[model samples]
Target: MAQLDISSSAISIPTLLIVNRYFDEVTSNIRERPMPWEGYQRASLITEQELLLLRNYSSRTGLKDQPTAEKYIDLFLILINKLSRMDALQYILVAFDDTIQKFPDTLVYLCQLEVKSEGSPFNTLKRCLGKDDDYLNLKAAKIITDLLNHASPKFVQTFDFTDLLLWLNRQLQSENPNVVDVSVQILQGLLKLRSFRPVFYGKAHLMNIFMGLIQASREGNPQMLYQLLFCLWLLSFEPIISDSLDKQYGVISQLVAIAKGASKEKLTRIVMATLKNLLVTAPGDNLAAMVAVKLLNFCDNLATRKWTDEDILDDIEFIRQELTERFQKLSTWDEYVSEVESGHLSWTPSHQSDAFWKMHASQLAADRGRLLNCLAHALNVPNQDPTVLAVAAHDIGQFVKYYPLGKKMVQDSGAKQKIMELLTHPNADVKYRALVALQVLMSHAWDQ
Candidate 1:
């Protein structure tokens, strides 16, 4: 929409032009050719002169005629509701897409019309989403996206987009790359609307789709990957979504992997921005999770590279500094918990700190010895890192020496037998740690 003084809105005109042209380019090919007037007349829809006027409206701009716009909208609704023929419907949709984009008055006018029943133009387009033809579905989605972009707050609040949002969710998993791309781009736009966030987020399968796309995009689809990450970047603005993304969906590891290998500058920029948002939104265990995934190391490496985008560098610097500061602030127990939960343990300070074990051993024994059981599982897993086995064995011994029921807990967790078997391990570090832990388990007077 433009202001009464066109000069005031001149700066935004170019951006508007780009958006309109892009929609025109990606919409159905039916817009290029003339409609089958003979077939439409055979179906008794409209006269030849009326079709010509509609065609003119499609190409015309700056249309300020209210009556003409309403007439065209009614025609589109009639064609959409009455016409079962796919091509005819597509022709009408192509016209609708053009008219609404070029003529602001028509878009505003259409949005103002209240929907009284299912056969409304908006609802009709929604129904087209279920059509078997991908082109029709795409056109329908584009129109819906366009409407929502300009629709009044009242209309958006009352409208039920659950079906449409679910369809978009399913379409993200589509094998067809174009469908997935368009769907993500639509979602990216929709998420910009604050009211739409909870609606889309409420869908149970949204995160699952994101997880799959994050994994799939790693196989070399930069456009799809960027678009998918863009949606995540938008969603990360919400504190609740950001929290769930890391805690429940485990997206930090996947996103970190993408950021680590992003070839395109834009891809790296978005991934960095998203990681930054997720980090800043909630930074307790989330920070630990990022650190455990070696994101800080990645940020360190990223910081050394020459980045053109200032935002990218800023995000990298911020994340690196935040991870570093918070990591230092993390308690010995928090560090130990992060390492064990990451499933990639190493010889960190916690494993050897006598005071750490003495202080947190009972805390580890608090959750029914959950952290202890995790260590026992890591110890028994075949082909685990010898350092990890060694660390696990040492922690078990420390737990036994500190906690009253640590020995029985180790036996219950099956780590006692695993530790005994590890005494014959090929790695000397693992064998020695196993022997010490076994002695502690047997209540022997072993030296610290």
Candidate 2:
């Protein structure tokens, strides 16, 4: 894979500058096309002085005073509120985009001025998001991003981003690469606000967006991958969100895959960092899940690499150390529980260990044959793995041999019936395992 040089700053840029430089280069350069009739009509709304203000690409410091900057904002808002044509509206938004990027102080001025109408600056931007045009929505989203980046906490709390958030979520699935990139960028920026984190996290489409970005990472766009991972990294800081990152979503597996083949240092850094946070913030079940997915091996592999970044090295060592300590603490029964809960059965060493069955088989019967029931459920699942069926049957048979009430438990749990049905399994190993378990179930304890 070809490697890309990703700036460390790209992942952790300051909030005030997030929408300024990092995003503008990729987001603002929409393709040039001929102006529509509405473009000409909207152009007429701009007075010569206002047009001059739009043309001037100078810094905010170059403006004479505060009132001049306010006048400039007033003109931009007037044009934005009045423009209905997509082409003309996009052009005005583009100019405002340049204004915000070049002159951030304009945000402060615009924030202070409130027009008395439905078409206020914030409302106008929100309305623009409802348009069908991706580029138009992108510009509107960028303007919103800049405002949010610099907006006061009071402003943030008072404003409703419900619809805008929904629009951004929909944009994540856009065909335009720029649209997807900016959507993630805006989302990442939005999530930085501590109060806004839960709002975005609470969205019904949150997990779908995550899965989509994870799938997109496989396409090998480093920047897109980094932005998506950065959002996950941010989400990991909140324990609630971190705990809910279920193993079933294949999130940990996908991230491990990314770490294994990541060509950029920044990419490796963020992936490991995210996994490390998830390990600590999530519960023991999640920890067991990490081990279940072989994250430990990936950590060991990362530990051997000659990493130039100390943070990456520290993160790798921390994950390896934590995984090792946690794995070491897992008792045989706990290991067995983790395996059973993972819904995948195999002939791990515990399955063949005579001592394991002697020590833990009675425990399986303790919780009303809960573990045995899980094993049976695994057996009963449609089109289950042959190996899983074989091992599940073997475990149930071992349970019956070691525990006095194990036969009754298995019979009651329907495990014996499933095992009997599996005696005719297509796979030789499965049929054989099921036969052995069936014989054990049918025989008396005195016979042994």
lDDT of 1 by residue, 1-448 (tens): 0112211211111102212333456454576766666666766777676667665666664245667666777778767876777877788787776666656666556666644443455777888898877667877787776666667666676678776876786687778766776677777666666567766777768767776887888897887788778777777767777777676666787787787688789888888888887887766547656756788888888899897788888888988888888878877677778887755677777778888877888877778878888888888676787987888898889989988777777888998888999988999998999998888877633332
RMSD value for candidate 2: 5.7
Off by over 4 Å in 1: 1-28, 45-70, 115-119, 338-344, 352-355, 373-398, 410-448
TM for candidate 1 is 0.78
The parts of candidate 2 lying over 4 Å away from their true place are 1-67, 112-120, 154-159, 219-223, 342-347, 365-397, 404-448
Q: Pick the candidate with the highest lDDT.
A: 1
Tens digits of per-residue lDDT for model 2, 1-448: 1211221112222223333343465344532333443334466855666545654523234455556656666766787776677766776676666656556677765655532342367876887888988777867876776666556666666667787777877898777666777678777776665556657777758667767777777676887788888887777766777777754454676788787778788889998888887887885647655755677887887788897888898988988888888889888778788878766566778998989989888988766777878898888888888998999999999999888878878889988888988978999999999999888877845564
Lowest summed-lDDT stretch of 10 residues in model 1? Answer: 6-15
**C-alpha lDDT of candidate 2 relative to the true structure:** 0.72
TM-score of 2: 0.77
